[model samples]
Target: MRIYFLSRRKLILLLMFLITIGGLLTINLLTQTIPSLVRTPGTYYMAKTQEKVVALTFDDGPDPVDTPDILNILKEKDVRATFFVLGKAAESNPALLKRLVKEGHEIGNHGFTHDYQQRKLVAEMNQTDQVVFNSTGNHTYFYRPPGGLVSKTQMEATKRNGHVVALWSVDSKDWRNPGVKQIIDNVMKNVFPGAIILMHDGGYQRTQTVKSLEPILNALKASGYRFVTLSELRTLDSDLK
Candidate 1:
């Protein structure tokens, strides 16, 4: 029989090295898996299309202050985007919701309140859907959760409520008040064919987002990209057909 023994100091050093390697591996696995795990199934991040089509989606909106400015900019630029509005906000601003529909913009469900219990998420979604339908006579088939945090169970509930999860490929991070230049830069950096850009029209002062809007549109237009609503962007996807 052959026996090998390490000194106590060497054993401690080896144990520390092993612990460091295990920790790194654990972090790497989590980084790779958590994003995929959090994303709901049947979610549309970007379309699979050859056309230079992009969808600009705003969340937590229909604000009397910022939403009007956003709609005005879209109207002026002759561009149409999707607004995912909360039910409470939609109820308070039916005219804005009506204007969104009347102006040829798309409306989506962003839940009743910003947050809800997991079991009640579907009810919240349905409530928003009802509000949208009542306000605009248009049923909202798309939904985005607050803070983009969704679980499998919540997604299943959303599916039961007949809503497709709408995630984003190009996140502007504009909700953080990241400044107009950074917002534009974030969108420009991730802009691509069939990209869905995330911005916000409600939930805090969206002055920076409002300011960043036109320049982003102009730059993308210069790059030969055409803007489309989320539904239209879905139609561009051959996979969906």
Candidate 2:
């Protein structure tokens, strides 16, 4: 009886060891494939584009004061960007949301309460358009995760909803109020073709964000890059195909 019990314990230990190894290997494989499958093709990086264009995505907003200012800047600069507005925030800023659509910028889902995980974010994104559209009822296709975190469930949900998970290639850390000059410098150094740049229009320390927009737009334009909304960039990609 003692031998039998000892043998059973050994067998259980071996099984646990195998399971741990298996789980690690599975995670490794998934981690390897994430970059390609998630963002860039085959590498999970930014989308490839021949055109000298970039996607500007803003999050955590629809701020009553700041969003309108950002929109005005876009209009004056002859540029449009993607606004990843939160779902709860969206309700309060119905007029601002409508204005985003009216002025020809892309309105992507940033999640209902600004959930950080990609899955919950995607789930929030799925119907944000419907709720917004039913208020006015037009089809819009854009989804960005809050704080740029994504998961398998989020990807699947986004794909099912016919939206791509938009991820950024450049971050100016503008949300940190890292000085307007520093913010400007970061972009000047980091900007790339088909780059998706992240910025926030409404969250705290956004004065720096508002400050950074103009010079970045002007400099990029002078450098021969065209500024376009999130939806327009997607259409450009589809047309390229």
TM-score of every candidate: 0.83, 0.76
Looking at model 2, the pairs that clash are: 35-43, 35-44, 36-42, 36-43, 36-44, 40-44, 40-45, 133-137
lDDT of candidate 2 over 65-158, digit per residue (tens) = 8898889999898788888877777777889888888888888777777665444554567567766776446655667666665666666767
The C-alpha stretches of model 2 lying farther than 4 A from their native spots are 1-45, 118-123, 238-240
* Clash count, one per candidate: 0, 8
lDDT of every model, 2 decimals: 0.87, 0.74
Please give the RMSD of candidate 2 to the true structure: 7.7
Worst 10 residues of 1 by lDDT: 31-40
Show pairs that collide, candidate 1. none
Candidate 1 per-residue lDDT over residues 1-241, each given as its tens digit: 9999999999999999999999999999865543233334567788999999999999888899999999999999999999999998999999999999988999988899988344468778888898998887889988888766687777777788788888888888787676999999999998889988889999789999999999999999999999999999999998999
